[model samples]
Target: MTAPIPRDIPDLPAIPGIPVLLPSHVPATAVVPPVRRPLVATYRLLVALIAAAAVSLELALGSPLRTLSHFAIQSNILLAVVLTLSARRAWTARRPLPSALTGATLLYVIVTGLTYHALLANEASPYMLPGVLTGEAAGPTGWHVITTQVLHTATPIAALLDWLLLTAPGQLHLRPAATWMLYPLTYLAFTLVRGELLVPGTPARYLYPFLDVARHGYRSILANALLIGLTSYALAILLVALDHARPNPLRHRLHHRAKTGFRLQPPVG
Candidate 1:
């Protein structure tokens, strides 16, 4: 018998019309009964706890009336909403999240983590380093630290870890990235309208310095917004690419018997 072909070396032969770039997971159309596993249960619970803590801290921002005005708080609220909703199915019935929801949430958190650090973090503070690393917040009080870091740092990291380690992949497509713009676009419209209505002399009329048209000039700010939107779409493309990079099928079979493993089996070239 040919010594069981070593899975470490892929043996795909290049044949005409044969698929080389096959999906790495079950097809999205596969019919299966809803199910729950202990491991999936654990992951869902962890995500729920993290999201809840972040939002609770947000609510404790000392001024219940004014807390939602800031975009950072709004985005984190959105993040909490998405994370909670995604976990519901698992929490109630022990099922994994749908691929599309998974991909969209992943992209949103990654974008959230990236945008805050790059464009908004306090460049002067060393603690701003977390924001920098997340590729990432500052709060005056202990609550601020928890909420801000959890929203900008911990939440994003948790969401990413949910995708990169605990979840299976191969459910995303290019078109959904286009759909992901709805939340951001709607939020932008709201921000602009609210900023315009603020008292005439308000210097920082806009929540973000970059979006403050009175200070930056409409032409300049619009250009910056357009550039950021383009960059966001580009990031969406990368998110789609990552979804396709499921753990290698060969490696899956090779290590099928492993228990409670957390290794990211690199895909074969």
Candidate 2:
């Protein structure tokens, strides 16, 4: 005779169509409430506005096509869009963007700033377009100066601040760092193709000096590109490392309260 099945235990195999459920004693996982960060949202929104304004001013004041072709302009535009969305998410207590997207955006903007300061800033006139288009043969001034500083200096610094001060840490991964190189690589290809299509004497045919195939030749241009690519990869890796190492500034207060068993009390009227 077959052993009798326990009455308390439903015969799950026999009841194939019936759903099995957990015991009442088992607790369901708690859902965490989303945190609303108004200050973070406001700051991000301001930075986004600044970036957008700078890009707009550049387009209006200079040759629109040439200005749009610049890596700095492109990166800043990405930053503006990303930050605007991030600001809305923060304000609404929505889940933040994926770490990979935020990290890549940060990396691109940093690269823009670093490349400008390290390579282009030292040029007598770093404007990609000729004086006829930019009207800055003597060097950028007035609104040009403001836009330049905002795009290359202020925007990157603000982004770094947002990441460091507002966002949680350890979200970035090493694998994503490698993937972040895709945009830079694509930009390199675009620069080469665009340069080839333009006539040799066309002003700003090659937007950046390092990628100027006409002057540097394909061999030298490739070498320069390789060096920059490797450097950018290294920077990305470093960013990932730093991200993992950084503490969660946004959670510090909560952690401190939990550790110390502290609670907030309402103020007496």
The model with the greatest lDDT is 2
Local accuracy of candidate 1 as per-residue lDDT tens digits, 27-144: 4323233333345446656765776666666667444434566545665566566656555655454445556666766777777777767766757532243322111132345556
Cα lDDT tens digits for candidate 2, 31-81: 234455788889999999999999999999888988988888999999999
Weakest ten-residue segment in model 1 by summed lDDT: 130-139
Q: What shift in Å separates residue 197 of candidate 1 from its native position after superposition?
A: 1.1
By TM-score, who's the top model here? Answer: 2
- The C-alpha TM-scores of every prediction are 0.69, 0.80
Which whole-number lDDT from 0 to 100 does residue 110 have in model 2? 95
In model 2, how large is the Cα lDDT of residue 26? 28
Candidate 2, residue 79: Cα displacement in angstroms equals 0.4
- What lDDT does the true structure give each of the candidates? 0.61, 0.78
